[model samples]
Target: MKSTEYITVTQLCTQYKVTSQWFHKLHDTGLIHITTVEEQPCVSLQAIHQVDKIMRLHQELHVNAEGIDIILNLLEKIDTLQLEMNSLKSRLNIYDTEQ
Candidate 1:
């Protein structure tokens, strides 16, 4: 594939031999994040590395996809809540400034 700024869906699919459905499902399930350029979905290098690690763990440890999905979902939820907490703290700081 070309070394463009962003990797296209076709390039990712072709390189990994994964179907589009699986790719999108993984993205939606929070197992991977894709970069978009000009409204086109592209693969991020960081996400590719994470996907590779997940694949290795599955292969080496015989972990099922369902288990991986659950773990990733929990991690994403934790990240979301952490960000929310930071926002709430900032809002409280604003109130403190007024008081």
Candidate 2:
């Protein structure tokens, strides 16, 4: 991957005012992914928004890592369900228009 596509963990920590331990907790709980780049750990740019949300949840809401993991899983499931619902509605509309 390109260096431009990932931000160093230290940069993220400094930007978000979070500790490396927080990043490690999120990584260990499978909330965020970390990879070593040039001997420095980094996270994908795509994950930055999620990292921001995680930080907000932890720093603002006082949610623990495990709780954040569960919350994220539930949110993902809801997103999937909403997409399925939209697809089903579109399919049903197609059938309705045929009548």
Candidate 3:
């Protein structure tokens, strides 16, 4: 599979050994994101990464789908907060230089 190109739902499920219902559930819970290709759902490399992380957590931590969702959400929130913090720090430094 091409790393840069998006894959169909079937390809994702086959590659990950999951079912369509499972994939859609993951998407609905925000644990993974999907793209549309010619009216069919497609998954990206980024989505594959997210799903891989979720799968690892599920296997290693014995987490259920709900737990996986919570973990992924927190991880995403942390990433967002970190970016916001960095932006604020940059702005503060600019202000400090003028003062």
Quick one: best lDDT, which candidate?
2
Candidate 3 at 86: error in angstroms?
A: 12
Which digits, one per residue and each the tens of the lDDT, describe model 3 over residues 52-96?
A: 788788767888788998877898899999999999999999999
Off by over 4 Å in 2: none
lDDT, model 2, position 44 = 94
Assess the local accuracy of residue 73 in candidate 1 as a C-alpha lDDT between 0 and 100: 75
TM-score of every model?
A: 0.51, 0.85, 0.61
Q: Candidate 3 vs. truth: CA RMSD?
A: 4.5
Output the better candidate (1/2) by TM-score: 2
The numbered model that scores best in TM-score is 2
Weakest 10 consecutive residues, lDDT, candidate 1?
A: 1-10
Candidate that beats the other on lDDT, 1 or 2, i.e. the better one: 2
* lDDT (CA) per prediction: 0.72, 0.93, 0.80
In candidate 3, position 11 carries an lDDT of: 82
Clashes of 1: 0
Candidate 3 residues lying further than 4 Å off, grouped into runs, are 1-4, 74-99
